[model samples]
Target chain A: MGGKFSIERVNEYLWEIPAEGDMRVPARIYADRNSIDFLLEESRNKEWNALAQIRNVARLKGIQMAALAMADIHPGYGFPIGGVGAFDLEEGIVTLAGVGFDINCGVRSMVVSIPKGDIEKRKEELARELFESIPAGLGSTGSLRLNFDEIDRVLTEGALFSLKRGYGTAEDLEYIEEGGRIAGANPSNVSLHAKKRQLKQVGTLGSGNHYLEVQYVDEVFYEEAARVFGLSEGSVVISIHTGSRALGHQIGTDYQKVLRKASQRYDIPVYERELVGAPIKSQEGKDYISAVRAGINCGFANRQVIAGLVRKVFARVFSTGENDIRTVYEVGHNNLKVEKHTIDGVEKELLVHRKGATRAFGPGRREVPEKYRDVGHPVLVGGTMGTFSYILTGTAKGMKDTFGSAVHGAGRVKSRKQARKGLSGEKVIEELARKGITVMAHSNKGVSEEAPDAYKDVEQVVNIMEGAGINRRVVRLRPVICIKG
Target chain B: MNRNGHETLEHTADMGVRGWGENIETAFKEAALAMIGLMAELDRLRIKRRIKLECSEPELEDLLVEFLNRLLSQIDLEELVCVDINVITIERLGGNYCLKATAGCIKREEVKERLLVEVKAATYYGARVVLLESGIWEAVCVVDI
Candidate 1:
C-alpha cells in the first residue's frame, strides 16, 4: 500500500512524490483528479503500487530528472505500465524489466480510401477475412520458416528484411519509428534459443490484449495535423497492436540473469529484483543493449509483416489495389532509446526508457519525419476491443516535461478474471454486434476477457493527456471490426 | 508438509501462479502445471512426447524462473500446446541449485480444449519461495502475458 509514502499535488494534472528514502529525484505523475483517486484506492489493495515503482526508478543510479508516469499509469512488474525515465549515457544503467518482456511492443496504423459506410456494409466478411489472413493467438506460426542464418538477418535488418522479401514496399518503412530498424543490433549477442523461438513466429499476433482492429475516423480534433497525417472523417483505417513475439520475450529472459549479476558487480542498489540494471558501459550492459535492439528490430519486422497481411486482406475483400492502402505511422511503446535532450541547460545524451508509453516527438524535432516536421509525430492510442481509439500529436510541453512521451492506451482497471466472472464470449460478441461492431476471435474466452468494461474509459484518459498538455488529440476512431487473438 | 497443488492468483494486468508441496521439487512441478492450466485445460491434453531439461542457478527463486522459462521455451519452439512434468528432481550442488525434469508434451493439434492465453515469460516481480510453519514448500511467481 502507498500509506508509507508521502504524496503532494503539484498541479491539476500533475502529482509529485518528493525525494525521500532511497530516491535520488522526485517522482512525477500526470493524471486527472479522478484517476489519482483510483490510484490511491488501487494502492490500498494491490501489493505493488505504481507510485512505489516510480519512486524505485528514481533511486536508479545516474537517472536524470524525475521518474514520470503518464495518464494511464498502472502497476506493472518493476516499472509501471506508463512509466518513463531517462538515464545518463555514461553513468546510467539499463534494466530488462524497465523496457518490459515484450520489447518494442507498439502500434501501427494505416489509412485507406474506403469510407465508413462501405466498411460497415461488409464488416462481418472483412473481420472473417482478416482472421484468416493474419495468424493470431498462442503458439501461432506464420508462413515464413527461416533458418538460423535467415533469423539472424531478421534480427539485424528488422522491417528492411521484410521489405526486401516483398512483404511490403520500401515506402512503408519511412513512417516507422527509427525507420523500422534500430542501430547497434548484433544477432551474435542474441541467444540461439531466442532465435529458435522466432523462426516461425515472425508475423504472428500473440494473444493477451494484442489485436487488429478496423476503425473509422469519427471526428478530427486537430484539423491541420489530421490532414497532414492523411486521416479524415468517415475514412476507414486498420491498426495492428502487437510486439516482438517470442523473440523479445526470450531476450528479456536471457538478459534478466545477466543484469541481475551485473547489478551486483556494479554495486547498483535494486529496490525490486525485477528492476535489476547494469551500468551502460559494462560488458553486460553492452550485450543487453545489442540484444534488445535486435528485439526491437524483430518487433518492427513483425508489425510490418502483419500490416502487409492486412493490406492483402483488404485488397481481396474490398477489391482495391495494394498501393491504395498506405501506412500513416508506426510507434513503439515499450523501448529504450539514446537521445540528446537539454537537462539543466546542458545538452546531454540520455537513454530514455518508455514502458507502456509512446514517444511523441514534438514539431521541429529532427526525429519527426520531414512530412510531419511542422505538425509533430502521430501518437496512436488504441482503446479496448469495443471502444474508440484516438490519434494525437506531440506537444512542446510533453518534450520539456516528460521527454515527449504519451499514454499508450486505456490502462486496465479490472483483472482479467474479474472481467470474465459472469460474462460469456457469446454475450460480448452479441453486444458488440448490437452496436454495429463486428467481432472475430480465435477463442470465446479471449473475447470475454477483453470485454470493454475491463478497462478505463479511453475518452477520459485522452482528456487527461490533453489537459496535461503532453499530447493534443488529432482524431478519434470508432471500431467497426475487431479481430482479437 | 501440505499436499501438492496449485492456484491462480489475481493481478491487475497479468496473472500469477502459486504452487505448494512437501518438497521443492513437487512445488516446481505443480507450478509448471499451474502455468499450463492457465493456457489450456490440462485434463484433455494428451502426453505425446517426452522432453528432458536440466538447469542450475545459485538461488532457489532463480532456479524456479529458469525451470518455468525452459518449459515455456519448449512450448513455443516445439509448438507444444500442452505439457505436464512427469518427473522432477532438485538437488544442491555446492553453491548452486540444480534442477532436472522430464516433461510430457502435447502438440497444438492434440489439444481439444479452448486455448486461453499465451504466457510470455515468468517475471522476477513478486517472485518468492518460502517455507511455511507447517514445513510446506511454496513457490509463487507472476508471468507476463
Candidate 2:
C-alpha cells in the first residue's frame, strides 16, 4: 500500500488502484517509481491529490476501461491535470472539470523554411518584433473587433471564419485537429456574455502559462516519426500555446451552474464539486457539449490567428515567403470529444475528457492524418520556456491502455506564489540570455511566475511515458526565443 | 486581527482564495478582493471610475462564485481594474441569494503595469461558505489562472 491507498505495481512504469469503495473500475497511473512515490505522498498530505482524483473519476458512472493519469499528473480541481476519463455514450456524463476552463488550451507547432542559424543570428530582434506583433498578456485585445453576428460565425465556423477574413490561409487548416473546427458548434447553445467576451479576444494569446516560442530540434529520438513531423536537427520551429481566451472561461462558468443542477436533477452522484456532470441524454448535457465545441472552435481560431501573426513576423524579419512557413501539427490538451474506441473486442462511442492531456492517436488510426498515419500524429508536449520540450507519437499499446492519451507538459512542482518568491523578471531574462535564449514578455511578473525551476523536469516526465511504451519520442526542442503573454 | 481580510492560498496549479469577516456580506466582499488581488496591484490602481455588479444564485456557495466570475468577465472583457470593493447587499430573494456590489476602478490601460496575471474563472472546487466557531464568517474557493 502507498500511504492510505492500496496500489499494486502492474509493471515498472505503471501502477493501479484496485476497484474499491464504490469505484466502478480500477484507476491506473502512468509513472515511474519515484513519481508514484511523490503522488502517494501528495495523496496522503494534501486535500487535493492526483491519485484521489483518478479514483474519483473511476467511480463516475459508465467509465469504460479505467481512469488513467499521465506521467505528468498533478492535483487539479475536480479532475487531476493529465487525467483521462472515457465514458459510455448512453450511461456516462460530461463534466466541466474534465474539460477545464480554458476550453481547448492547446499547442500549434509550425516549421519555417529558414534554418535554425538564421533565427540564432537575429534572435533578439525577432523576439521584439514577434512580441510587439502578437497581442498578449492581461487585458490585451486582438486585431479583430467582431460584431455579435461575426462572433457567432467564429463560434460556428471555428478557424475558417478567420481564414475567410484573411487571418491565415486554407493550407494552414490542413494539419490542425478536426481541420480546425468541429461540426457540433451551435451558436444558440452559447450565451451572449460568452460571445461578447470573444468579440475582442478572438486572436489574443492570453496570459498565465500561455507562450509563443521559437525553437530548434536539439535531438531526435525516433528518426522516422521526426521525418513525418517535418523535424530535423537544427530546423527552426514556432509553437504557440493558448486557448479560447475569455470566451472559453465564461462558457465554463455559465455551464457550471447548469451542469450542477442537471446532476442533481438526474440523480448522478457528484463525487466532487467540479466533477458535477449531466447525463449524455439530458438537454443540459447536450447544451454544454455544443457550447464546449464552440469554445473549442474559438481556441482553434485564436491559435490560427496567432499562427498567422507568426508568419507575418517571419516574412518581415527573415524576408522569407509567408507561404514557406507551414503548420506541422496542432492539438488541444484540454478537450472533450466523442470517439469510437474498442473495449473488450467491441467498438463503442465514448466521450473522452482530456484535461491537461492530449489526444495521441496511435499509428494507422483513421483519426491520424494520411501523411502521418504510418508514424502517428505528433503530440506537442510543452515545457517551460527555459527547459526542453518534446514531440512524441502515440503507440498501439497506448491505444488500448490509456485511450491513446499522453501528457501535455512538465506539470508544476510549485504554486504560483511559491514560484514568484525571490524571483524577478529581469533576473530571469538575464539567466536565460546566458543560456543562449532570448525572452520577451508583456508582464515582468508573469515571467517570474512561470520560472522554469517551478516545474518538474519535462524530459523525465516524457521518459516515464516512453518507458511505459505508451508513446515514442519524435524530437527534442530547445528554445531560442520565448514570448510570454 | 482585521475584522475583514482576504488572502490567496497556495495551490499547486490554480490558486485557493479565502476571505474572513464578521458577517457573510463582508466575507463575500473580501473573497472578491482575494481574487482581484491576484490580477492586479490594488494599492497602485488609479481608481478613476466605478463598476456596479449584481448576481443572484440558488445558494450562498454559488453566489460567491457568481460574484467573483462576474468580476473576472469585467476585468477580462471590459478591461476594468478594480481598486476597491464594497458589498451593498447579500439578501435572500425568494430561494436565491442575490448579491449587489460596486467597485471603485480604473481602465486597465490607465496604469498598465499594475496588472498581474489574469484570473481565468472562479470555480466550485473546494468552495464553501461557513460560520466558524470563532464567530467568523468565511468564504473560500479556487480560481483558475
Candidate 3:
C-alpha cells in the first residue's frame, strides 16, 4: 500500500486510482483532502489499508464502471468497509467479503410524533424499559421461537411474516426497501444450521455496535426535502440498528467455504483469502446469492419485529396510540442487489455489492416510495452514542457517479482494544450522561469498546459526501437515549 | 500478549486470537480459549456441560478457522460459554487435517451479567498456523465481531 500507486486527484472531493496490472477498472473514492491524507496514513502505518482493498476490488471480473469507496472508508476483511462494487449480471462474481457476515445490517428510523421535552422528562424509565423489553447483547434470544418451516416462511415472506404475526402494521411494508421482501430468496438454499441459529434470534439485536437509539431532529439543512420526509425541527424519532443475527453469521460461514472452493474450481483469481468468489452463473454462486437474499429478508423481518416492540413501548410510556410513530425509512448497509443504472447513458441491470455502505436511489426512481419520489428516499446515517446523526437524500449526480451509494457511518479510527484501554462501562455512561445522552448497555466492555472516541467524526464524513454532490443532507438528529446490546 | 499460552490480539474492527503450546492440540485448545475470552468473562462462568466437537480442513490455518466456527455454532445452539477444551487429536485424515475435541461449556445464562460481545465468525483473512523453530505450535486468526 505504501510502495507505489497510480492515484490522481480528480477533484476536491474525489480521487481515482487508474487500472494497472490485473485491475479491470479504475478505483474511485469520495473524500476531502484531509480524509485522503488519513486513508494514506493508515496504509503508511500498515493499519487497515482501505485504499489497497479498493484497488484489489478493481481486479474483480466484469466489475462495472469503477470500484468505489465512500468517504467513510476503513479497512475490512477483503473488501474495504464503505466499499461499493458493481458488476455485469452475466459476467460478475458473488463474493462473501462484498456482503460481509452481517448481511443486510441496516438502520430503520421511525418518526415519533411526541414532544421531545416530555420524553426527556422520563428518559431514564424509557431507556430502562427499552433495554429490558428488547432482548439484546451476546447470544440474546427473542420471544418468537419458530420452527424450521416457519423460519423458511420468515425468509420468503420477510416483513410480511412479522406483520402476519401482528408484529407491525401492513402500511409499514410500503416504506421499507424492496417492500421489506426480496423475491429471489429461496429458503431451500439456506442451510439447516443457519435456520437453527435463527430459530430464537428473529427479533434480537446482537452485540458489537448494534443499538436502538431515541433521537430528535436537531437541525434541517434542506427545508423542502425535510418536509417531504416528515422531518420537523425538534420532532422525536427512533432508529434501530441491527441485522440478521446468527442466521446471517451461519450463512456467511457456510458460503465462504463453498465459494472458496468454487473460486478454485472456476480458476478465479484469489486476490485475497477472503476475497474468494464464483462466477455468477455457477451453481455455487446462485445458491450463495439466494441464501444472501434470504439473509436480507431476515434483516427486514428482525427490524419489523423490533420496531413493533419499540412502538408498543412508546405508546405505553407516553399514553399515546402506537400509530403515533410512523415509519420514516428502512435501508440496509451491507447488501447485494440487482439494479439498473445508466453507464455511458446505456441503462442496464448490474449486480451491486454495498458492504458497509447503503443504497441512495435518487429522485424519480420507481423503487422509491411514491410520496418521496420527487425528492429521493432518506439515507439514515447513524452517529455515535454522543454525536449527531444525519438524514441524507440521494441526487441525480450521485446516481451517475456512485450508483447512488452513501457511507454507512463514521468509520472507526481506533481498534476495540485501543478504544477500551483503561476505559470502563460506567465511565462511558458517565461521559455520555455529561452530554445529555442516556445509555443502557448489557456489557460494560462493549460500552467501552464502542466509545465515541473510537470513531471518526461523522459530521465531517457526511459533509464530504455533500461536498461531492452525491448525497445531500436533509436533517440532523441528536441522540437522547441509547439501548445497546 | 502472552505467546506461550493464549491471548487476544488487537485488530481495527475485530478480535485477533492466538494460542500456542508444545503440541498442536494444546495450541488449538488455547486458541479456542482466546476466542471465548472475547465473548464472555471466563471466570464468571461456573456451570459446565460436556460436548464433543470436530472439524476438518485442507490446511492447519483453515482447520483453525473451521474449529473456531464450529465452536461459534455450538454457542448459538447451546447458548454456550466454553471454559475448557480437550483437543483429543489433531490428526491428518486422508488429504485433510481433522481436529476433534471435547469441551466443557457453561450456558450463557451462567455468565448472564458478564457477557462481552458476539463474535460473528472466524475469518481466513490474516489467519496463520505455524510450528515455530522453538517447537511451539501456534494457531492464530481474526474473529469477526
lDDT of 3 by residue, A326-429 (tens): 89999999999999999998999999999999999989999999999999999999997778888999999999999999999998878888888956889999
Clashing pairs in 2: none
Tell me the deviation in Å of residue B6 in model 1: 1.2
The model with the greatest lDDT is 3
**Can you write out model 3's per-residue Cα lDDT over B1-145, one digit (the tens) per residue?**
3556998877777778989998999999999989988888877456468889988999998899999999889878988887778899999989999989988888888678878999999998778899999889999888899
Rank order (by DockQ, best first): 2, 3, 1
- Tens digit of lDDT per residue, candidate 2, span A192-225? 9989887888888989999999999999999988
Best by DockQ: 2
- Model 1, A55-116: lDDT tens digits are 88898888889999999888888899999999998889888777989999999999998877
What is the number of backbone collisions in each predicted candidate, taken in the order shown?
A: 0, 0, 0
Q: Score the docking of each candidate (DockQ).
A: 0.74, 0.82, 0.81
Identify the CAPRI category of the predicted complex in candidate 3.
Answer: high
Q: Give the DockQ of candidate 3.
A: 0.81
